[model samples]
Target chain A: MIRTAFFVSGRTAITAEILGHSLITQFDDVNFRRIVLPFIDTEEKALQAVAQIKAQAEADQCRPVVFSTFISENLRKLFVMDEALTLDFFETFIGPLEKELERQSSHTAGKVHAISNFEEYKHRIDAVNFATTHDDGGMAKNLQDADVILVGVSRSGKTPTCLYLALQYGIKAANYPFTPEDFADHRLPKPLHPFRNKLIGITIEPQRLSQIRQSRKPDSQYAQLSTCEQEVKLAESLMQHERIPFLNTTRLSIEELSTTIMLKAGLKRRCY
Target chain B: MIRTAFFVSGRTAITAEILGHSLITQFDDVNFRRIVLPFIDTEEKALQAVAQIKAQAEADQCRPVVFSTFISENLRKLFVMDEALTLDFFETFIGPLEKELERQSSHTAGKVHAISNFEEYKHRIDAVNFATTHDDGGMAKNLQDADVILVGVSRSGKTPTCLYLALQYGIKAANYPFTPEDFADHRLPKPLHPFRNKLIGITIEPQRLSQIRQSRKPDSQYAQLSTCEQEVKLAESLMQHERIPFLNTTRLSIEELSTTIMLKAGLKRRCY
Candidate 1:
């Protein structure tokens, strides 16, 4: 079955989408087409959103499910429609939170997305620049500034994981690839030796690594399964010999890898 | 006063953190020390998390707030503690969702982080690679493959926005900086002429742009206020003459800029 869902919010609607997605995905039987209504902080915008949702529901011949994070009580009521199912995040949780915390919510609109803390925001932007500059062993002189350095075979999901850590968490992540020369021996790379405590090794299963490499470069020695197996085995052996903690990215998503890396490395997330 | 909060989940606690952070931030009076306990998929791990929360609560002499997305009923019960205020996202929302949809939720654990859609995952990886290669006007010959091209003066928040769009939304974004040469003339650069339809202009206020540039290259002509004003004025005028839709990124976060760019370009997000 196809269902229409609206993720409504007074701000960016990102929180609404995250909460809504986590809930709606549980109903695996229905395919949901999500529409995001962001920046609807006023009564007029709320009314327009209601009309839009009602029209969409009527056109689809189904009651549209709305998941909202609107903070204003008056604006939240405007979204109440007889033809649609509306679930307000703040309404459901805020009262209970107030009781527990012994204070009412500030009820501020769009504060979550504001760049209120310039220092923290600037740190995140600087971290992004750092990750980009140090990506794939691009620069080693500034390795000391990195919060975490990722060591892995090429195409073992290093770049994206580093970037995610940098952008999402304000983590200064740098990555280095194990080349053919490095696989000849068990010694850590000279540049990485000084930052042993910050190193997190990432390895992938040979078959998966081969498939990934094959997509990038077809019919090459670099993409052969035998070469991949040899490199991965040697990489694992080196990491074990050096007592470097490692993760297998064979069956993990980037988010999983980054989160696990943060935990394993004991790195603090500089931003929320 | 400072309070402790735990964002716990069976998978990556990203959703938990997003929801928890959004709610916790509304109470501006109290400072929060946020901790993420992710990959708590087992009963033993859940028990350990509960013990950890209890210990922290006792140490603080205050009850901690626990926000969880544990889909398993058995595991969810393990998190309830007298010393903690628990908010289970799935427990709170899934029942109502099931009742509304007239269906039972799968109640599966950690299904959201699974890389079940390989094609979609691969596309995101490819988009990230594309954005990296084309960052800062590095590559322009393959502009045809770009889903969106961002044009702006240096440090106007183009590279990070492109990377965010690529990693977060699976949009192939390429960025080009408008150099002093481009400012000398009102015409769009030659390479950008072919893909004007895919172009989205980004502008920043002169003072903000000057501040950003000053940090990067102190005491240089590039960082001078007059230079920033001239470049911004020229860029905005040129964009207006070319009828390119633009956004001011001075007050916008990278997430906001990327989302707005996606909307302005009418580009369909290739992945969620």
Candidate 2:
């Protein structure tokens, strides 16, 4: 049995669990151990955890691949020095983010300005709040309360993106349907109109959208090859005309789509 | 104006934004610059970000404290080495979690399993799902679908917790109101009797309950301190006699209470 352990350290326990579960889902036929140690606030704890994993690996006679999020340098160094552990995926993944944060830090210095236009931002917040309350299927409301809102047609990875946003960010994110109704109207739904600035549209390659929809609805007009092409064209045109920023959810995980959308929308980020 | 930039690197951008917003709420007078750098998946990118922040700090003449989550170590080290930045709070918080994960890796070598027992944990998921559905003031339904049904008086944090569990862990947590009608009848609601083994009770301190109730209905009997106290006492005694596990949500955050109840009920964790 290949032994794997996910060490998630963050302010939010729920976020760690979601990420751990998703990572576990990527592997097949592997024995996985998930232990959540919350409130990891220091370097000493990181080292102690490393020592424990090293001992466990020797006892089990198996090399361990440790997947960790939010570990400190002092402890990470101890793991790196050990010859037994094979991989440190967290270090590999976070490498880019840290660098970017540093570069951006200088550019943003003295640039952080509060919304003196609190009234404007407040209006935006209220619009979103209204959109959330008015949405049907209880789904719209769920996403409207989201720190970020994703607008897209069916199967553009809205549900998954919403779930990822909620699960990973603990943000109440809502996705609204860009249905035929919205398409024919040639405008965002009336409820979404006021929050237009916060409105982000998600588009996808027509072929990809069709493929995804095919899995769910197969024979419907919504999933038909031609219909998908037309819808994509129409949605893109609408977003362009209205000047709403949109993203292609095709070939992206819910994580990727949400990150791109949030970036484009300039939504406040909760997680680092 | 003290400018603060939030560097978010995570799977969910909206979550990052919501967290950013929440953090912003913590300060009374600070300039907040919201920068959304998405799809940051490499160390070099993190370095670039660090450089950017450093420049911004020099320009602003104030060292910036970065709020980040899920950032990598190589990047974190780069930031730490850079004297331009003052704090990386997420990095500090994740330190301990890394160590704990390393320690557990040995004992549970390859034993960590991502149990697809969502079906088994369906009740908990249902309850949460129900709460989310009901939280936006939707109707309670599919009581038959609940796992361990929760019955309590209103304002018990039932809806919030249920939604949290569902949205966070995908637990199917269903909650029913122990209305005066149900109490007068001296029986569990009709649908809940069949799932008695799955029934859990929730109660709150009378004063807290009164306070919460007052928010929705000021000057109502239900919001009276005495009335709340009576209901809580009755609910507690009844649950004890019925052998149902119960929790008091008065002091617990929705997260802590949910974890405690799930553990006490032996409910399989839905997320991790």
Candidate 3:
């Protein structure tokens, strides 16, 4: 296998790896070593990255692939003489957009990953707080404030999906757990009655939920497959009885689950 | 404000909105109504999007700005005849990378945001589990497997930062709470003493901490500025005394805080 060293010029390695992965991972027989260049903020940092890249290339016997989300033209110029396969994010999108919009590009690095707009940033922070505080039916009193309240059994991917909704869309997502007693109640839970419009019931395959529970609590009654099946069936019946909008978490990823939740709830994202 | 409509062709509106937000939001005195194109999977979906765009344009009396992260060339061709300033993601980066890497682009829509790599995807799910379970020392008993542990006073942003690190980088991050009592010890908490090397202390300014606490527990003793001040000072000194790496989260965003934490700890991203 051909080993490829990867050098990224950004404050963090996230952007470079995200855009690069979908593109680069398709290449067969190539092992990628992702090295986030130390102190990549200015012209001096750019030179330091180059020096490190040069040393890595000599050791590896192959030119490193440089993926840049760097915005400044000054910073991009420093890498022009470097011998590497460069994928520049700003150079690719900015020029065309500047001409198209008839405006100047901001050329700001880490725009997507950074807090470029403090309002949107704060929205995310608030959403995080809301999701965490309202998690696992922790604060039933706070349910009415939630934009969307996710209801499901414990260990059924509720917490992660709610957190994703918070982080990605700045949606105030709260989740409530259905216990054995709550599941036995033929009627809807009393706490969830007032905000039934906000309730979106989540269910999962018994096997999957069992496996998840077993991972957390091995060989316990909670981890039993029979218990999972009974709970999931009861939850589904309750959702139908209550006429609640429901979704299956058996196959959906967290992002997909959050999107579908928003779509079903008809909730608008507070911030992008 | 002029009413301008917009269309994006992708599996999800998320990537389109995220990359488009920073660049598009800068335009002053213009209102944008972004319409995500109807399922762009076939020729019919393309025609549906065109019809919707046409109706929206007619209603708004302005030519729209179209941003396509649509991967298929066939689908892209359908938009070529449309009258709008198109911002294409594939046409920009794929050509250069194709030439440099000597591989054809996958041309798949939503590859980056979707479950392109299952291993990386599973890492995120597991990291999220690790983060939620170990949050605020809830599962301090399970700290042996954590890649890193975050310690901070209440409302100093430990939970959100840990979650961000988990979601973004797939790092197994656990956060421990430090009360005034623990901080008075002038060293790491007893439970965290074993994982001292894995510790990354987090601090926030007293004013910011007070504001955050006030929002959570309004008018409470925890929201008092003096309490915040005393707690923060002790935490910072404890970190210094133990030679533990720390960062102030008052001005830093979640992205910046996670990046700084990783850099200070010399931690590599466990997954993308």
Off by over 4 Å in 3: A1-7, A26-31, A58-60, A116-119, A180-186, B1-9, B25-39, B56-62, B116-122
Q: Please give, for residues A118-195, the per-residue lDDT of candidate 1 as tens digits.
A: 677777888889999999998998999999999989999999999999888899999999887987867898999899
TM of chain B, each: 0.96, 0.64, 0.89
Tens digits of lDDT, candidate 2, B84-196? 43344345433443353343221111112212342433333244335545442245456555544667887676755565566455667777777666666566667666678
Q: Is candidate 2 or candidate 3 better by TM-score?
A: 3
The interface root-mean-square deviations, each candidate in sequence, come to 1.3, 11.3, 3.0
Best model per lDDT: 1
lDDT of each: 0.89, 0.56, 0.76
Per-model RMSD to reference: 1.5, 9.8, 3.0
Ranking by lDDT: 1, 3, 2
lDDT of 3 by residue, A1-272 (tens): 45464646556655565566655654544567777763388777788877777887788877777877676778877766456777776677667656756677555566556665657767888999889889988888978789999998888888888898888789999999988888776777788889998998889999988887887789999999999999999988888988988888776667667777877788777765
For residue A171, give model 1's deviation from the true position in Å.
0.6
Top of the candidates by TM-score: 1
Worst-scoring 10-residue span by lDDT in model 3 chain A = A22-31
Fnat of each candidate: 0.68, 0.06, 0.22
For residues B72-168, what per-residue lDDT tens digits would candidate 1 score against the true structure?
8999998887999999889989988898899999987766666657787898899999999999988889999999999999999898889899888
